[model samples]
Target: MNEFRHVTVLLRETVSALRPRPGGHYLDGTAGGGGHTGLLLEKIQHTGRIEALDRDPDAIAALKKRFAGEPAVTVTQGNFFQAARLFPHPGFHGILLDLGVSSHQLDTPERGFSFHTSAPLDMRMEQDGPTARDLVNTLDEPSLRRILRDYAQEKYAPQIARAMVAQRSAAPIETTTQLADLIAAAVPAAYRREGHPARKTFMALRYACNGELDGLEEALLSLFNLLQPEGRLAVITFNSLEDAAMKRAARQLTAGCTCPPEFPVCVCGKSPRAHSLKPVFPSPEEIERNPRARSAKLRVLERR
Candidate 1:
């Protein structure tokens, strides 16, 4: 296996904003390699505690080794969106979610998230979940088009989805290389090589396979009662879709009413749940070292 060299993006800024207290409880929702969790635990050495969660088994195993015999830590294997159910704690002082695919997953050919390398069309963050191949091969043209258009915002979604449906009839699209070639053929030759044509299709498929955006809203709602008063919930999102969801959730949680703007008097009984701290971005220095951090956006909420 290749060495896991994930340089946790937005490391300094994320940990610094956390401002962890010695006796407080914290959680790292996506503990890839334990990079951020390691720092959080170090801050909590004598009095605080850390609960680390990861969907990837390998990451769980690696983190277990990295934090072994540390009474200050607890490691769990599963989606962080399901955290409230998994953790025994009624509330926590701090929570950090780094929502991005790890460098190890992308660089490993067998996992198939990158166009630079040819591999199986498997993009499961969890090893056992349904993969890109299954979605591409089984969904109807209209369904595929909706996924591409809605999730990836691909302008040529209809044409690409049509072509995919027609091609897969001959045989199942089994490999990432084959799928990439098919998407290239679907796009106009004049537009070819401007960027990988398969990029959007792959992203849409992965999002659908993982049901990423589907459960996000509810997860945020669940976390509202799970954070202690004055506790912080920090989320780091990689794309606009995820960022938008987080933004809307925070707004809803913090705002006093969902009533129409024309309303002169308060009717809706919804009170403010949390306050939105301004969203933070990666520093140019951090982006220079890791270009993948370029699009990352971090939004934090403080329970009221």
Candidate 2:
């Protein structure tokens, strides 16, 4: 197996924001490489317990090994969105979700998350389910176009989708390099010079293949509901789509009366369930050390 070395983005900021305490019950929903989990474990010492979950089998294995013989940590192989089913009770002191692709997923060529390397077009975090290859090879042009535009905000989505359809007509686009080359050929030369032409396209494909955005709002609501009073939910999103979704969810959670200005009292009787803190960003030093951290944004919300 490839060495799993994921530099946890906003490590200190996330832990400090959660304010873990002794005997506190916390959850690391995305236990990639166990970076944040390790920090949480340290802060809580041996008094608190953490339930760490990861969809990736490799990450689950790593976590199990890393926390072996440690009574304070419990590792599970599952998705964060399905966490409610795992733990029916609603009394978590804190929950941390470091969203988006992990460094290990991108760095490992076989995962097919990065356009920098040539590998089979398989971007499944769980290593099961439909893959990037299936989407690129089987999806119709319109569906592909929608995923590119909606997920990645790829401006030239139509052209890229057209190029994918045209290229795949003769042969299957089976590798990351193959799809990247096709995207480079489809876009204008000036656009190609801006960045890796395949970056956005690959991102879109990965999101679609993994159903990254499906039921996301519901999941966020579920997570918030599971939190005890004053319990915190800290999320680290790597893209604008996730950031915007989080903002909208936070607003909904913190929203008060919906009654009109003329109304003397709120007939709707909707009270704020949670409060949001200012979103946090990575430091310049962090960005310099890990360029991938440049786009990361951390948002924390506390249940009322």
Candidate 3:
């Protein structure tokens, strides 16, 4: 827990953009360690309610412990996509989506979220799900290649996928070290020296196994619908794919008149639901303290 308490990226900016008020209802979609939730609960005052959601059981437990005896807070152990079903509502005043693997996940070797750590190759946000090993062991070469190419944006995905298929025939790819080593060996020498050779491959496998990107897309739409008129939504993304999705979704939702150009009468009648808030980022001081914050990007939207 101490490790996770270090620093959350764009913490102040994100919270400020949320602008929670007394008695306002709020949701923390990725309540990892309750760091941001704790702050929100404090700012929202005792009357305000917060329905915090996390898919990981351990994270939920941690949050419950951290925020014990606080009736204003309802800790839920489930994906945020279920927010609409989890609670009956006209919609919340504010919603926060911190979309990235938490520091706890990266620090814990058993979680297998980091290339520096040699664990079981499991990267599911849920404690129990089809792990990286399961995908590597069972996925055919073509599926593996597509996952790497599409999810991780790896250029040598096909070659790496082919290599993985060949290597697994000799032995089961059981551990993080095994897969990392194989990926490192498969990539070109120039790329190998630039960064962890397994970073892209691991990220791709984790996304595929957890269905993270697709889940994010669904969650974003659900969240938009769950905001009260003039309510606010904030999302923090750690990767290009996630950031791009957020950018596009924000643009589409905030855009007015979605009717086709030929439809001069505006038959589609799609009015803008939300307006974009200035995207947030870490201060130089915060980034210096936590290098991981360097990649984080925060986007905010206000329901119209």
Candidate 4:
């Protein structure tokens, strides 16, 4: 395993949104490489406890080793979506969720997250279950097209799906380079000039293989429910799909009433449970240093 050196995006802003206190309990839901966890630990000053969780075994191992003998930190190997079951007794003062693939995952060629390098088509964050190769070879043409279109919003989804199906009939597409070449050939030369033609296709496959968006709503709701009164939840999303979901979740949590306009009496009896804070974006200097931070957006909400 290579050294997990992840550049934490919007570091200062995320911590500020969390509003960590000396005695407050924190949750680093996606503790990739422990960059954010380290900052949280510093703010808490050994007075608070942090429960850091990650689905990747490599990340968990790295975190355990990094924070060894630290009485304030607890590292766990699990998905943040299953956090509700993972931590039954929840009174979290703040929770941080940096959603999407980490820099370490994309840099590792064997992980098959990047098209720049040649490796097996395995994009599982947890390193289990069906891989990208399995999905590329086994899924039917329509299903493949749907994944590309829905998950990645790829415009050439149908063409790419047809090309993949036709090529796999001859031999299994077992590597990242093979799939990249296939996608490049499926799209036009002009289209390829805009960006790596395989980028969207690869993203769709990874999302589908890991079921990334399936339980996102439930997970966000679960985290929100776990917050202590006036506690904050900070989330950093990379793409529009995730941003839209977070916005909707925040709005739903902060919505006040559902009673009819004509009915004067309050029938629903529902009150706003949370409120959204101003969103934060990376500065020009930050994006210049880390291009991956270019698309990052951080949104926060506080329990009422």
Best by lDDT: 4
TM-score of 3: 0.94
Per-residue lDDT of 61-111 in model 2, one digit per residue for the tens? 889888999999999999988989988865999999999888889889999
Worst 10 residues of 1 by lDDT: 39-48
**Per-model TM-score versus the true fold:** 0.94, 0.98, 0.94, 0.99
> In candidate 2, which residue pairs clash?
none
Model 3: clashing residue pairs? none
- What's the C-alpha lDDT at position 126 in model 4? 98
Report the Cα lDDT for candidate 3: 0.84
Arranged by TM-score with the best first, the candidates are 4, 2, 3, 1
Q: State in Å the error of residue 127, model 3.
A: 1.8
lDDT of each: 0.84, 0.92, 0.84, 0.93
- Global lDDT of model 1: 0.84
User: Residues 8-103, candidate 3, lDDT per residue (tens digit)?
Assistant: 678777877889788999999898888778788788886789888999777877888878999889999988878788876747988898887877
> What 10-residue stretch in candidate 4 is worst by lDDT?
210-219
- Residue-by-residue lDDT tens digits, candidate 1, 11-58: 766776677889888888899988899888777664678888899877
**Alpha-carbon RMSD, each predicted model:** 1.9, 0.9, 1.9, 0.8
Candidate 3 segments whose C-alpha is farther than 4 A from its true place? 1-6, 259-268
